[model samples]
Target: MLVAAKGERFCDQKRPGCSQCARKRALCPGYRDMSSQIFRDLTQVTVRKYHAKRSQSAIASSSQNKSPKLVKAKPSLSLENVALNFFIRVYAPSSPSAWLTYLESVLSCTDANSQLSLSAVLAPAIAIFSHEQKRPSLMYIARRYYLTAIADTGLRLTSIQHAVRDSTLMSINLLTLFEARAFQGRSPPTDWTTHIEGAVELIRLRGNDQFKSVLGQALFLDTVNNIRTSCAQRRIALPAPIQDLLQTLLQKDSPPLSYGILEIGVGNVVDNIIGLVAGMQTGAVYCNDYKAVILEGLRLDSQVSELSRQLWSIQSYRVLPTDASGAWRWSGLAHDYDNPQSARLWNLLRMLRLYLNKWICRAYKKAVFEQQQQQKEEKLLEMGQEFQHIPETAASNTVLMAEYILSSVPYFCSLILSLEASSSSALSSTVRWLIWPLSVVAVSPLSPVSMQIHARDCLRKLGEEMGSAQAVEIANMLDNSETLEDWYASHPRMIVDQKAWF
Candidate 1:
């Protein structure tokens, strides 16, 4: 049926008039005309005593009961735009606690670029860098394993580069480097250099970058510096001098460096122990105790960073808002479960719970959903108490939330338009897929259409609530006289669908 639709935006919402209406403009219906029965629990509506004594110059007592007006919404990014990046970074996002932590975290990596889906997000470089230096010892654990795996035992190479690529040889070299006298203040023997080179090559070829942004050179340098500085400051004794070579490489222009480590979502003092699978035997240079050793350095960086990030996240989420439609809107909503701030908070808490505490990850999985829920509530309450009075920074948070959800409804309407375009059945064509959902939402709310019925209730109630001054204003607005259902059914759909369906 033909309809007098207004601006294209409202076409998904309402039309001014259906074909059946002859005087179209006045026939149009919309929520701007609807009666809302929200907040009806009040047992009495009190008139202001001041109004009884005031002259006609005083505003009417019934004005304040008007509905909360629906204001124009501001623009914001779509959820799909944000979700697109979510999948790519989940797995490697720069820490063992990132996508690598307990196998379950792998579910976050939906993007094509992330690698090492199941390894716990970890900081092995940090661990290695934190050690004390002492007597140097050399060990060759990889030779026997290599002898078992290599089929062509005599692959010859003059340079260290080719020698390490033969997977079997590469694995042996890493073991030798980690055990070498490097940490003991002795230059890493030739074998250690060979292993480091192999790791650099593997990282270049296989490591995913989108999410692996964490373990870059910055992290590596920080760990090495932290450990070396700590050791020097405290004069701690260690069996090897791991920091010496690391310090030398930090000075070099080029090294086989990953970000070396990142501290994005990891926790310190809270999440230290979980089950650790032995490091992957993949053809990477890092089989050099780097993975195992990086954890200690991470713990320190995490200790320093977590407190600040947590406090910031909490402060960001204190204020809640009611949307123009009178629905409560939450903020920083990534996927409805929680906002980025909340996720960061949870990540911090979960990580801290595991700090240096062994078997925590293996135990986290065993914890019930109810237990997790309890933890969330506990944390929420703790933060709520801390930042109870902060005002919301954004006035239009509610408008943004409603508009975001509303924008997508048009897309669904378009889909229904397409479906109706193909359906041949006349009866079926009018039954748009989008209508059922709208009908479900519109059927409730006791709305009054006449000014006599709706305005008195509207003004008296408005007068009873925000006071007589606000009440007179609200009642006048409600005097426009239309039910919310009129607005709902007035929305236009593509008529071409019926022709196609028939």
Candidate 2:
């Protein structure tokens, strides 16, 4: 028999290395007998999911039985911990007291450094309020954390005070900034009143140059832009002074930001821009005034380059070097999406630009002829990779789309984990986890309704990923397809095989 030529079989107990498997998985059954099929099973993570956590629990237990870390099982989670986790995810309580009680519960524990305390409540508290979608009190939870930080860490330095306020500011800034970035290319918080308020607060707080300037500087441009923005919104003057300051800043020959002052300034700017664009108000006034300022800023902005340089230096999420043409394609590494604007936007912009470039190159061939030509480049980092040969069928198209969703699943999972304490994000987390298997049903030989049920299940889990239009585009590419045939007819091969067929 030509079994050897057929490649490794999972049915065979001896499996080849992944490199070998990669060369051979297509022709052969995986090496674990039918066990290789485990990877494809979209069933709930189920029993096997707890392998490490269980080990931790056992260690926790063994520590109780034998070790010092658990003299009285100090690491043991308390009822408060449970309640904190519960409140963080479900919001079962109608009042802020419920949330505070949970935080207090964690605080009641012996040492403040308990992993359960931070992991279960505070960290997630940050994530939850960040995406709560309830804006009545944007920094409502931040006030809680501001107090908690003081309680937990004991404020000593002026920077500690600065940190407390800045952390809260960062939370507000990050949420709005990302909202602006993802909703469209609009950047920064542009609301004049808010920017002025924030700047005034910093000034009043006796902030240092490093500490205070971010607030003041962020306001300087944003307030002007916002005032101009409002005028533009109401069809008012372009506000030339604002234009001049923006130009002066853009033109000023400055070195890149040093970590201390630079990050604060740039971060504040980013925060403001983030808040600004989240409003998504489009107009000729913004185009002529604020838009020009931002473009000029970008052209002259060293902060972005600094950020880009810092992002490039991270070893864990390393993507390809900037292409020969200096193109920074998105590498699709939202694995650690702590910096979603940088990670998600980087890939999205790369893809968007690539798509636009393809269209331009085709429609205006002479333009490309006149311009300097650069070779097509790969995405900066892998920008995520494609799955292997999904079964070929009309369903393959659906499977293809689903696999991309599955790939993005980890990113959403990271978000969920960050918000694990927040019932909302937990629900989001659960939804993202639940999405994969349900998606798998459609691609499998299961009945059509099974796929539909799976589709419904997936949409339910999609939470944040499903709510936005762009996410909807990604989702439609995932769950929203009408017929498997339509995807087959219209979907490009790359689109179909992004994950499996890569």
Candidate 3:
């Protein structure tokens, strides 16, 4: 053993002991041999230590048993599960077509192709979630998934069996929605229209077979609705194939008196109006024909109005009593419905009516201008007297339709904000549908200043709260464009030419 003085560094263990002491010329103690002392007897001390340890272990075991057993930790949910759940809970319910509900079964399937369906649904879910949460990084992830879905969809389209599959069409439709919401103001306007065109072509390929299943029928109706909106926005006539497909669907299905049925009727009138607008823009329909066009619009308007009346008569709504505190007031009154679906149908009807009256007003102006150029002063005066009430009535009706749309806003907003989770799906559908009506009313020249302001505010709120990028874009458009003409001028894609009517 080597011993050192206090404050000296300890000796490093070595083969020989007392090296430092020997180096210092001091006495060195001999090292002990561990082998010689290997078998020391201490049975009494060992027994005491073992007994003490056993007693401590017994105490701990008894205390643990007296207390509650530990709970098993639950596994955390995966990102895919979270995103999928969000889609089903938030997005699917709000969708008017309910075609998305089919995704549950598609995704539940255990097959290689089901991965594509999962990606397709998740892409939009993540995109919407990113927008709602203001998470830009998540948007890149969303786009990656979107690209994957597009690739998968393209592959599926190569085969007729896969292309017409409900899962495949659902993916395409979901991709279209992603375009509308995720890419709206960012992507070229034609992106959404082109996406919809592709879907329509697929539907044409499927033909009557598309309506065989309930899911397929819902998807077809949804695609038709998208086609009408796209054509209207593009200032083009609805494709003849789409018209033929719709007629075929009606003849074969003969859908019951419902919101979808009423929408088909309104869609026919809308298609005619869209064609009239396109013709007028391309000089196919001359200004001299404005009178006949106005008459046609009125007739279509009457037809749609009758459809609206019949639909509402079957599924009526109530005007919710105005809040005394004015907290729930939107343009002074809020209309409540038996359900959000009915509310959505009603607003769409108002929108079609608004468009009809708007074009009718344009036709009236054009007809009056043509008469002024050709007719003599006396004859022109007489013509003016005869047509005096037409424009005024159209304008007045346009304003009223715009107001009615505004009035419905409060009810939708209330439902979206206060409804329970179970009812959120229907509420969401209503809110999503409300965005278009709100945008239409917000930009209408005939809308009163107060109504326009209210509509714009409602749109802003929806964009902020509901994550509707379209609503935000429309609000921003309203903000930047001081007048309706300015809006049209800035968004040239929405109109065919300067002379075209909105």
What are the per-model numbers of colliding residue pairs?
Answer: 61, 37, 2
lDDT of each: 0.27, 0.33, 0.64
Best by TM-score: 3
Q: In candidate 1, how many Å is residue 317 off?
A: 7.7
Q: Lowest lDDT 10-mer window, candidate 3? A: 493-502
lDDT (Cα, tens digit) per residue for candidate 2, span 309-396: 4545542243333333321111232133444333333332222222222222222333223333444354311222321111122233
The whole-model C-alpha lDDT of candidate 1 against the native structure comes to 0.27
Give the top-scoring candidate (lDDT). 3
- Each candidate's root-mean-square deviation in Å? 32.3, 22.1, 20.2
TM-score of each: 0.19, 0.27, 0.70
List, residue by residue over 1-502, the lDDT tens digit for candidate 3. 2344233534445546545655666544555434223222332233233324333333234334543343211112233444555666556665555576666655545444333344577677766666544566776667766766676677678778778777777888788777655643333466666677888889988888877778778888777777776676667888888889878777764672233565556666767877877776756764457776777778878887897788877788787776645543564687777876677667767877887778778878876787778864564324446567877888788887886777777777777777535433344444556666777787776767888788888888887877655468778868988444334323422321111111
Model 3's C-alpha root-mean-square deviation from the true structure amounts to 20.2
Give one digit per residue, the lDDT tens place, for model 1 in 1-502: 2233453223223344343333344444433321112212211111112213223321111111221232111111121111112212221142222212222222232331221111011111111121211111101212222222121112212223433232223233223223331223222234333433433333333223211333333333332222222222222321133323333443445343332122222311222211121121243222333324234424433453455365455443332233334211222222221332233333333222222222222222223243465565453223334222211211122223222322223233333345443312221222232222222222212111221242244234434432333234334434453343223112211111111111
Query: Superposing every Cα of model 2 onto the true structure, what RMSD results?
Result: 22.1
As a whole number from 0 to 100, the lDDT of residue 254 in candidate 2 is 52
